[model samples]
Target chain A: EADIYQTPRYLVIGTGKKITLECSQTMGHDKMYWYQQDPGMELHLIHYSYGVNSTEKGDLSSESTVSRIRTEHFPLTLESARPSHTSQYLCASSGYRNEKLFFGSGTQLSVL
Target chain B: AQTVTQSQPEMSVQEAETVTLSCTYDTSESDYYLFWYKQPPSRQMILVIRQEAYKQQNATENRFSVNFQKAAKSFSLKISDSQLGDAAMYFCAYRSAIRNSNYQLIWGAGTKLIIKP
Candidate 1:
């Protein structure tokens, strides 16, 4: 089984509320990424990190922000939730030399 | 620019049968990587198989095998003796092997595979 984990498997909150999705990996990989997926559609890259203290926006523009203070932890925070932000967030990690990505179970966020 | 395409949005197959999922990609780079990833309902995405562009031989993992046609730019997945557990969204992804590239996977719109019992 993959060591990557995402907390709050499912979340539903009212609009304007602040929320944070947690992602952690025991693999000690330097490259981490967060993708936004809508149901069975294609994945949209939102944020990624090369290592601790390095974060970059992905191909898609997202309102959520991510912080990689530690190698094992990468958390995404939304200042104000909106219905548009209601989508599944998936976290993944990979070593610098390995191109394979290990993904988390994903967190399904719903904004009411 | 590189792009992956899964023309079949959805496909179905009887359990214990074989099924092929089609995937095609376009890229100017000669060397790259092609991957097949499976995501079950609410489950984490997992790598099914991988094929390096430079290799002439196809890659296979257990019942999962890929038909890699470099000249045609086609990488189709063949699942033998399909099981109900194989039902999931199958995605085709491509990554550039060039140095300095972000190594981000260019994904195709996934194809939902339904295994009928």
Candidate 2:
């Protein structure tokens, strides 16, 4: 069973549209991360949060923004989506005791 | 900067046979953790096995085992008695054992395992 969950497994939107990807973890993990992946490619870290009110940009640059107001809830928002934003967004969470991450079903976004 | 590489983009194996998937990483840090994750057609990323760099002993779980060569910077997953369910995209990952709660994971391009009957 997956402790982490992501909403809207698949999405298609026009350019200039705004969208938010929701991620929630039931495990109450303090560490949450967002990774962008291309088909058959390596995963690129885009955003991460240590806990509530803590968020940081990852190694990879992204136009999207993320907020961690609640311990279990972390959402990524793209104010103005573009074709370059079209990719799979994966949400994951991990506890401090062990660094093993629990990943959620990724959200595939397509911008036309 | 750390980088993990999986040379084989794809590998084929017959059912009930053994196969090894190669993984090598480049890092200056001495202490870290290595992992192998499997992503099947279901698209769910699952943890297959893990190895700690500090340990000299290898890690194994049932049909899955890892030949971790810390000095050589190599971590390979060997599957014994391959099953159809084992056919999936296998990824190698690296993580620092640091105390930072916001630790990040470094991943490879992944190798697709094909099981033939």
Using TM-score as the measure, the top candidate is 1
Per-residue accuracy of model 2 over B26-116 as CA lDDT, tens digit each: 9998889999999886577889999988999999999999999988999999999999999999999998877753357889999999999
In candidate 1, residue B24 scores what lDDT?
A: 100
Top candidate by lDDT: 1
Q: TM-score of chain B, per candidate? A: 0.99, 0.96
Candidate that would win on DockQ:
1
The per-prediction tally of clashing pairs is 0, 0
> Model 2 chain A: which ten-residue window has the lowest total lDDT?
A93-102
Model 2 docking category? medium
Question: Candidate 2: misplaced stretches above 4 Å?
Answer: B100-102
Q: lDDT of model 1 at residue A1?
A: 87
